[model samples]
Target: MERKSSSSMRLPPAVQAAALAAVGGSRLQKEFAWMSWAGTVWRLEGQSGAVYVKRAGDLKDERDRTVWLAGRLPVPEVLGLFGGFGDDWLLTRAARGVPLSDPSLGWEPSRVARRLGEILRDIHALDAAGCPFGERKLGHVLIHGDYCLPNVLVVDGRLSALIDLGLAGLGDPQDDLAAGVWTLQYNFGPGHAREFLDA
Candidate 1:
């Protein structure tokens, strides 16, 4: 990831103050490579630790789902959520892992595919008895709605954390399965999709 001085970008005053308070410092770095139309992500490192701040049009859904999944699965801790300048800023402690999309990690294709399948299975197995979002239908189960490679983090070759929960909720298992297959193919090539689905 490319890091640029935070001064290059401008954040709403209230959002900037909240991020500074959460990180306990004024030093901030922006991950320009991760910026997208959906939102912009920044990293703040300080004596307290490293935290990530994401600014988007709205993040209440992500905050709510992440909080709901706290004990059930691995996810970043919600440090703070602030709203200002017609945008929502979400602050979360950095997860301890690298995204599977990082090619420099040198992960083997077959192993990565299998691991992704295992992690997705674990997510789907969670009971959704009282899940606040998504319709409670007969076959619904908890799912990582955007189960793409970048959303999954790997540490020591094992699944460590899942992020971007804005679209997560109780839903058809196929939704995650299909996304997993697509991401595996997109990242590792066509032959890995079947390995992921069959793992």
Candidate 2:
């Protein structure tokens, strides 16, 4: 993500205050500007640690899913969620790993594809008995609605964490598999999508 001045993307006063409080008064840097949604992601580094503050039109869904999946999966820890001024702000501790989309990670396509498939398999195997989100259709399983490479993080070639859970819920496993296939093709070129599916 490119670093940009927080001033360039004016956050609502209340959301700004909440973010500051979550990070104990740190400088906010614009990390990502979402194109698919009307949202902005900011990073804050403070004495406590690094945290991410997300501002969106609505974040309650993400917050709820993240909270529910806390112990069941590797995901960011929620710091706070605030709503005001026509926006919702979500503050979470930064996941500790590089996104697969980071070219600097130097991941081999075949191995990464296998690892992604394994991770998705584990996610699908989670018991969905008490899941409070997503429509329960036939053959539905818990899924990460957006399972693209950028959302999956890795450390030492192992899955570290998953982020951006706004679209997570009980859904067909194919939804996640299709996303993984597409991400593999996009990040590592063709010929890896089938490997990801088979692995």
Candidate 3:
């Protein structure tokens, strides 16, 4: 039987080539997760830097725009976009930090949480500009919606950038904050619950 249509299908050859064209290079790697649609992320290597491809008409448009608008705040640079009709993709430079699951994380969970709080505040502080990207409006300030350690990138003990922001959008900042607290509680486990919640 055919699978549900709402789910993302792999990009065909022409579609992939068009993405490559849009991003200005051949594909380097693809990022995926169970919660996200397939082929939503494509990484291409170019002489100048890396390019991240995102299919257009993808629901992720909001996050892309938010990150681009909040460029000074902290996010990977969006180079350009391609495709349409839900086939659109974006090209962006790669960030430098390793994932939060890195062994070193055990040494810095609390520090990471605090820094993440500061970064979240910066993103939430953007004044409402007449956004051209057509993203959902932040009733207060834009929130990443999924502000977890895994999504926060750090380098040289500094928060370098944020990724998996397609989930980013307008919402009560508490929604993101609560999730951050819960994620910390869950991942660290047991006795750390209160500490995480307090964060």
Candidate 4:
């Protein structure tokens, strides 16, 4: 199977040149998990840190607006965005934290499960009253389309950063809670899954 290069997404001249330089016009070496249908995933290393590149994802405008609006919120920063690469390409700064899957956090399944639940709920509690980004209407919110343990990063045994906003859209907070439930089942255990879900 031949892997596709999402080079067609629109990009700023500098970003395009950087992409070309990063992949050497051959093929990118890293691929992140599935977050959406619009673009190809790749581990993009930037001057700041590891960045996940979503090419042709049609999220350039939404993401730009959302991040810009949520700047005060506890989300990753948006680095840059482009629309000339043939597809909409969005560049977001990677959040700081180890994935929740890291065994170093806690051995007890219930403990981590509860923590995950609280973290997400807290994020959803952010005041969206004056939110500048119309993501709720534009289809970008708390419930990630592909929310999973790998997409969440935990640092010092606390939820720190979240990745893969490809599915960010408007929906009930339970949507994220449900996804967290499934992730908890996979990470912690089926027994404690409901705790995270019910939270």
lDDT of 4 by residue, 1-199 (tens): 1245433333457665555454344333444544444556555553434655666736765475447445644466766666755566666655678777667665477777777777777677665554443345543444544566766787776667766665564456657777887888876567987666555
Tens-digit lDDT string for candidate 2 (1-199):
3335544666667666666676665565555534345366777666556777787788988999999999989999997788756678888888899888777887688878888898898889989888989989999999999998888999997889999999898998999999999988887788887667887
Off by over 4 Å in 1: 1-7, 84-86
Q: Which ten residues in a row have the lowest lDDT in candidate 2?
A: 29-38
- Local accuracy of candidate 1 as per-residue lDDT tens digits, 1-199: 2335543556667666766676666666555436665577877666566778888889999999999999888999997788856688888988989888887778788878888898898888887778999878889999999898888998987878899999899899999999998888887778887778887
lDDT of 3 by residue, 51-97 (tens): 55555466356445546655555677765554567766555667778
Off by over 4 Å in 3: 1-39, 46-48, 55-60, 104-106, 129-139, 167-170, 190-199
Model 1 worst lDDT run, 10 consecutive residues: 1-10
lDDT of each: 0.82, 0.81, 0.58, 0.60
Q: TM-score rank, highest first?
A: 1, 2, 4, 3
Off by over 4 Å in 2: 1-7, 25-38, 84-86
Candidates 2 and 4 compared: the better one by lDDT is 2
In candidate 4 the C-alpha lDDT for residue 149 amounts to 72
Instruction: Give per-candidate clash totals.
Output: 0, 0, 9, 16
Ranking 1 against 4 by lDDT, winner: 1
TM-score computed on alpha carbons, candidate 3: 0.64
